[model samples]
Each structure stands twice: as structure tokens, then as C-alpha cells.
Target: MGQKGKKIFGISWNVFVLGLVSFLNDMSSEMINPVIPKYLTDVLRTGELLGGTLMGAIESLSSLFKVAFGYISDRFRNRKVFIFAGYALSTFAKGALAFTRYWWDFLSLRVLDRVGKGIRTAPRDALIAESSEEGKTGKSFGFHRMMDTLGAVAGPLAGIGLLYLMRGIEIERAYRYLFLATTIPGLLSLFLILFLLKEGGQEVRKKISGVSALKSRNLRLFLLVIAVGALGRYSYAFTLWKAGELGYSLEGEMAFYALFNLMYALSAYPIGVYSDRVGKKRLITVGFLISALASLAFAYARGPGTLVLAFLLYGVSIAIEDTAPRAYMADLAKDFEKGTVIGAYHTVFGIFVFPASVIAGWLWQSYSLTYSFLYAAVMNLLAFVMMFWIRDKN
Candidate 1:
């Protein structure tokens, strides 16, 4: 039975608070994501030199940190401390971006922000899963993702507005103001998370064999396939880059990015709720199918108008993709091992993302956009086929 009036939208109060945290955090993040590549290229003078490769490298390193943070959180049986540190650290990263002068400066701030993300994500997800009522896991994760993407939508639109206001202003100057605006939301996120997040009764740490979390066959298969798929899904920095290559200005590209997030926000919860009713593995497979198709569309897009279609399809793929795989991984976890398993899954999956971006960048530089995206399409198709091996048992 539902919680009657005790809970909100079938999720616990902690879930709601965590979702609100993500909403504000993503608002701060998306404000900068759309403009990062452009800012590097035009303002920082690093575009032709280290653009995609460095973006990939920083993100990869951030993913690597998740392993350590996850292990520590499990070891201490404390999620709130790491989560508070993560949000606070990200808040610092956002404000620090106001003075970035070179590529390394940007890298340092971005990595710091991502470090916070890596630290908090696994433990936070474990908290949500553990707190959810039976049969509500998918919907809970979906609701959190919906709030997150809603912030993504708002952030980019806010950036677009700032871009217009700062038009005729120096590119770096405009971005500085954008950075300042994001800090407000960032600080709010930190404050809310600090006061609102709960650790509850801490569980005792269990001793498992070395890398014991990977002993489950279904979990192994799931992680491997997802990793393979992620190799094709390189830096989304390329998405904004492609839009600019097609002649859209920064504001225009941000608008499309907003559209992408809008579709994702609108669809994520519904898809998650549906996955709960149907099956997570089945919905995840369908996500792979949609992702393969969207990759192809991105490959062929020639104008902002075409990109509209691509982003919409990409949003559908993302909405379906976001909720299911992680929820399935959660389903496969032992009670005390959820954070570690989730971290391991993320570590393996993220290991390939750096190389994927490097390869995509090389193709974009040496080959063509079509080649770059088609490579991704093939990988997603492979992932789609691989999903069948997973049983999705709870």
C-alpha cells in the first residue's frame, strides 16, 4: 500500500530533500556545461589544442574518485558527511570559476566539482534505495532524476538569458557574470543539503572478500554492457560544439540544450514509474534502442532545426536510460553492499568515457562528425543486444 498522506508522491521525505538538492546542484552545473567548450575555445584559447581530450580526462578522473568515496562511505556507514562535503566542495568550484584564466584553471575547478559529484552519488543513491518503500525503487530514482533534469532545463535557459544580457560584452566577461549567477543556486544547494540530509541509524560494515561485490554474475554482465555502451556516449561537450559548427550562436545552442533537458525532465518520472510496473531490464533495453537511433540522428544533423529532432530523441533515450540501469544495479546489490556495488559499476563504466571522448575528438578532428556519431551508434546497438543477458531480478 501507498504511504497515504505520510509520504509525498509515493516517495519518502528524504527522497524529496535529496531530489531538491540535485535540482539546485544541476541548475548550477547546467549553467556552465553548455558554455564550457565555447568558453575554452573562444575565451581561453584552448579549443584546437586540448578541448575534448581534457574534458574527457577531467571527467574520467572524477569517476575514478567515486570508487574511493564509495568504499569509504560503506566502511564508515556514513553517507551524510561525504554528501555534505561534496555539495560544499561543488559550491566552491562554482564560485572559483569566476576567475579562470587558462585551461588548467578550468580543469582544476571542473575536477573539484566532479570530485564532489563522485563522492556523493553512490552513497546518496544507496540512501534513497534503502529508504524507499518496497516496489518503489524505480519511481524514487526517477523522481530524483526528474527534479535533476528540471534544474538542467532551467540552468541553460538562465544561461541563455545571461548571454543575451551580456551580448557585445567580452566572451570571458559574459561567462564571468554567468558564473556569478550560478553561485547563488550552488550555495543554496549546499545549505539545504547540510541542514536536510539524514544519516539515520548507521549499519555496521560487513567484511566481504576482495572485490566481492563483483561476484554476482548478473551484476558483472550488467556493468560490462553498460561500460561498452558508455564508450560510444562520449562527452556531451561535443553536442554544443556540433551545434556551433552548424552556425547556431551560443544562445541558440543553449536553447537546444534546454530543449533536451526539458524532454528529459518531462519524461524521466513517467518512464521510471512505468519501469516499476513493467520491468527495469526491459525498459533499459528500450532505452538502448532509442539511444542508438538518437546517435544516428546526431550524426546526420545539419542545422539547428535538425538538432531539435535529435535532442528530442536524445532526451527520450536519456530519460529511459537514466532511471533503469542504476535501479537494476541496485536490485542486484546485497543489503550492505549497495554503495560499493554502485560505485564499482560507475568506476567500470566511467573508465571508458575518457577514451571514448578522445576517440570521438580525434574523429571529429581527423575524420568527420558523421563518423564520430556512427561509432557511438554501433556501440549503443551492441549495448542493446547485451541487455538481454541480464535477468533484472529483485
Candidate 2:
């Protein structure tokens, strides 16, 4: 093992540093994430349909760039620079969101922020895969997800504290202060990526486009299954909105969102380790089933108790969905094509987020909130069926 291969508590040094980077970035991101929907509705006065459409469009549009950047990074054999640029761009966009008074400006800033995510995600995951010890890919991605979600857990709790501290301020100003403050952790994450993370010397393979990654039949099927799941996976903003619908105050809503992240943080690592032994496909299928169950819980939720169960189930489902799939993709890809394959996977999953969210919002605006969740449940059930058709052994 070279310098990058050295392990800290069984994780590669680069992987550990990247986890730290994500922890800080996610802390910044989640602080803003749980509040974005509320901010749009309460402050900017956007309707539910518009808010959800904007959120989905922000995610889907940026995600379209992943394959391009992933292929570029793979071609250049450089991950660090793309990773740094992406995070930096997002941090700037998020911080500037504090100043937006117009919905269009808000949408622009949000798209800029997600574009940063698109740029960084594939390269970052590929770096983690490259840094992992042999046969420990699942564990490596798991550790990264755990650290990332721990930051998510901390972010909302911090937001609750901040909101309390600013209880006397006007609500709009208070939200602005929160957005501005996210810059602190976002910048810290960039620091780690710039100074500590290292790119390894990867095998030289023949030049190929992102489409070349589609040669794997298993991967093609897996992408279809995940696309179905993505169609059902409404934005987390809906969860926060649910708390509002159930009559929770702002602090209560933040705490509720934190619980979801807490469950996600706690479950990711152990599940990752478990997948390493039992097989990622099995765990991933379970994740989709859990997501379906979570949707049903939300669809039928009558009060706080049902909401709690829904949040917990959704959290665990997301942990599995976010972690195991990447590791599974790593297992399938040639070493040289990790970024391209994972980027393609993310692209397929992300592209559907726009329509899913818009449809959910449309359901809420046109009929009822329960209908939106029911729609999600149906899509997840479809994905659950599709999962069994894959031929992968692990």
C-alpha cells in the first residue's frame, strides 16, 4: 500500500479525507435543504406546484452534466480539480441564495448549486472506489455515506439552534442568515479536498466516450430498475412540507427532518458492511421495498406518529439506495471506467427526478397530498418488480 492506500480504521486515507470533506459539505447543504421548500412557499410565495417543479428541475438539469464531466475527468485522469471546482461553485451559489428576492433568481442559484453536485459526484465516487482496499468497496462507500449523513444530522440541529438564537428576528431575515452561514462548512470542505485528497495513478485504458460504459448488460438492467425507483422518489422537501401540514412549528419540523437524517446516518455504515457479506443486490432490493413501504406510510399518515414512522423508514431506505448502488456499480465497472459508469448511473437516476417531483406536486395541487404519496408507492412497487429481473450474482 502506498501513501494513499494507508488505512485509518480500515478505510483508506483518501477515503477518510473525502468522507470528512462530504461531512462538512453535507452539513452546509442539509442546513439549507430542509428549509428550501419552506423558504420558497413562505417567503417567496411560490405555489406548491411551482416549488416542487423548480426543485426537480434544479436537480434534473444539473444531473445531465454528470456524464460529460465524468467522461472529461476520466479522459484527463484528474479527479481532484473537478471535485474542487464543483464544491466551490456550489458553495458560492448556496451562499448567494441568501440574497435572492425573486423566484427566478432563486431558481438560478439553485441550478448553479446542483450543477456543482453533478460535476463532483461521479469523480468523487470514482476516487473513493480507487482508494478502497481490495474487496472493501461496499465498506468504503458506506463509511463515506455515514460520515456524509452525520453532517446532515448535525446541519438541521444546528439550524434549529440558529433559528432559536434568531427567534426575535424577522423570519425572512432569519432564513437569510441561515443561508449565509452555510458558507463556513462549505468552505471547510473545499479546504480538505484541495489540500488533503490525492488522486492515484490509474490504469491507462483506451479512450472511450461515456456511452462506452453501457456495454455491461447487468448495468443496463440496473439502470432501468433505478430509473423506476427515481420516478417514485419524491424530494425530501415533501417530508418537511408534511410536518407543516400536520401542524408542527418550525423547530419541530427541523427536528423531524433531523430524525430522518439521524436514521440515515446510523444505518448507512452497518448496511454497507452487511451488503459486503450478503450481496449488494439483495440489500438494494430491500431498499426499494423499504422506500415503497415508506411511501405507503406517508400516504396513509394521519398524525405525528405515522409521520415519525414514515421519516425513519424513508431515511433507512435512502441510506441503502444511496450507498449500495454505487458500490454495486463499482463491482461492475472496469477500473478505468469507474467514473463514467457511476456517472451514467447517476445521470439515469437523476433525470427522472424532475418528472417525479413535478407529478407529486401536481397531485398535491390538483387533488390531495395523499395522492402524491400514493403515486410514489406505485412507482416504487414497479421498481421492486424490475429489481428481480437483474442477473447479477452480487
Candidate 3:
């Protein structure tokens, strides 16, 4: 490896290992993602209104807990334990899906899985940042994202395969098979977390407490920007729903999802490297605009061509949002409580996502899917305006 590559690769091994853990976890998680909403509506005979509500509740509740767990991890200066516990929780949640016959049971397990995500996400990202050098933060995060996306790619593929294998079976049985198969990857992720990733070397520095960190003017503004951006962004479930409306088969929809992940994975590193050179704030602004455009396309699209373009733009937007915001958090955070700060940032951002999703779901049901997309597009426009207020020196 050359100097930059060598440096990135050196600390990046931890990221790589963590990526493997994510890969396994995503393989488990994605199996559920494209299927669960359908299962709720089609198999369990739950209505779309209830399904959307459940989705919003699970996502928001999970995000709320991430803030709490992230603070706990930072105060204790031990990230590994939280990570391990989080993975274990997810493993259990995946298994629990097999037994879920009632809507509440399914929703409860979804919340549990999200709880694990909320706990692990901040500390895990903090670890990636701490393991890397300042200039390489974007690259490090990008690499981690790539690994996460790799799992995203694999998970749905596995789901597609399982669906094919059980093609003749009843829909509920097919979901059960997917749930059981997903557990294998989930448990494997936990095992990797235990054996591969290291913990407990870095000392917690003396700094402002979590509440005080939230008081920082720059961080507060950044959180506001992310919240606005998130409002414009709806869940990917909407994208799949759009594809279905366009007459794409489930397999075809999965292929499009795979295509999106492929682009997202390929773009993450390059975008991260570019952001490091250009400025994270600038990249974030650009990302929001791209997402705004994508939402517009989705809202107005009347045919397959427009849907394809929208999904492509959606993939690129994700590349920017996922990598740049993370790099920005690392830049703004104090060394001692990096995890806590990032957690707070995500927590605040996530708190808004719940309302955004609920509104999006409601709009989709009551008004039109196009209106939901328009709502998200408007949020992105507002986020674009807010970018002018952000100072990027950090």
C-alpha cells in the first residue's frame, strides 16, 4: 500500500473487522427489511396504516435509546461491551421474529432489534473515528460504510434466495424461513464482535458532560441541519412500494435494491475522500440538494425510467449523507466524549425522523404517495437553506 492507503489500511483493520460484523448483522437485518412491511400488510392482514405506524414507532423508539446507550458507553469509556450487548440483543430479536403471529409481537421485536442498533451505532462509529487519523476520518468512515453496504447487498440477496427456495410455500412460511436463516448471520455477527474487535485502551478525558456538549452552538446547528435533512428523507420502504406500483416483480425490486447498494458501496469511499479535501459541510449541502432532486423525481415519476433515475439519485444521496455527516461529527466532537457527542447528534436527528416518517406514512395513506415524496423534497430544500449557517472549520 502507498502512504495514504497504508495509513488508512493500518487503522482500517479494526474498521474492516467491524465492517464484517456489520456485514453479518446487515445480512440478518436486510433479510427482514424488504420483507417485513409486506409481511405485516399481506401475510398478517394488517392494514397499510397500521404497518406505517408500526414502522415509525419502531424506528423512533430505537433512535431514542441510541442516545442513552451512547452516553452510557462514553461515561464508562468502554465501547466493546455495549457493542457486544447490542449484537446479542439483535440476535435474540431476529430469532423472536419466528414466533411473532400478532402485530404487537412483531412490532415489539422490531423495537428490540432497533434498540440494539441504537445502542451500538454511536459507540461503533466513535471507535472507527478514534482508531483513525484526523485527515483519514472520512476514508475510515467510508470504509466502514462500504462494509456495512456489502452486508446490505448480501442480506437482500440472501432474502431473494430464500424466497425462491420457498416459492411454492405459504407466505408466512417463507417469512419464517427468512427469519430463521437471518438468525445464522445475526449470531455470526455477535461472535465476530466478541472475538475480533478490541476494546478499553483509550482513556476518557475530562470534558463537558453530555448535556453540556449538546449546548455547543456548532453542534446544535449541525443537528438542526441533519434534522431538516432527515425530514425530507423517507424510509427506503417507500422506494420499494413505488417499484411495486410501477409493476416491478418482487425479484425485480430486489434487483433494483441491489443496484442501489452496489452504487452506494462503490461511491462511499470516493465521496468520503472528496469530502475530506473539499469540506464536509460543502459535501453535505450538495448531498441534501441531490436528495431533494431525487425526492422530486420520485414524487413526479410516472414511469419506470423516472423511478430508475430516482433510485439512482437516491443511492448517491445516501452515499453523501452516510459518510459526510459522520465525518462532520468526528470533526466537531471533543476527544473525551466523542461517542457521547455523536450519540446525542444521532439521537436528536433520529427524534425528528420518527415524526417525519409518521407524517410520510400518513401522507402516503391519506393523501398520495406523491404527496409524501413532496413533503420529503420540501424538507431537503429547507435543509439546503440551513447549510448556509454551518461553519465548516472544525
- lDDT (Cα, tens digit) per residue for candidate 1, span 165-237: 7899987788898887888898888788777666734332445335465687877788889898888876778
Q: Ten residues in a row with the worst lDDT in model 1?
A: 200-209
Candidate 2 structure, TM-score to reference: 0.97
TM-scores for all candidates: the values are: 0.94, 0.97, 0.94
Over 4 Å off, model 2: 1-4, 204-213
- Against the true structure, candidate 3 has what lDDT? 0.81
Give the per-residue lDDT of model 3 (tens digit) for 1-394: 3212334355455677787898888878887788776787777777656666677777777778776787787888878889898888988998789888989888889889888888898888887887776687888888778878888888888889889989999878888878878889888888888887776344443543434556678778889888888777677878887787778887888877877787788888888888889888898899999999999999988897898899889988998998989888877777777787788777877788777778888898898889988999999989998998977565
Native-to-model Cα distance after best TM-score fit, residue 259 in candidate 2, in Å: 0.2
The CA root-mean-square deviation of candidate 1, after full C-alpha superposition on the true structure, stands at 2.6
lDDT tens digits by residue: candidate 2, 216-306: 7888999989889999989888888878888988788889889999999999999889999999999999998999999999888889899
On TM-score, the leading prediction is 2
Checking candidate 1 for backbone clashes, the offending pairs are: none
Residue pairs with colliding backbones in model 3 are: none
- The reply for model 1, stretches above 4 Å from the true place, is 1-6, 201-213, 391-394
Winner by TM-score between candidate 3 and candidate 2: 2
Q: For this target, which candidate reaches the highest lDDT against the unseen true structure?
A: 2
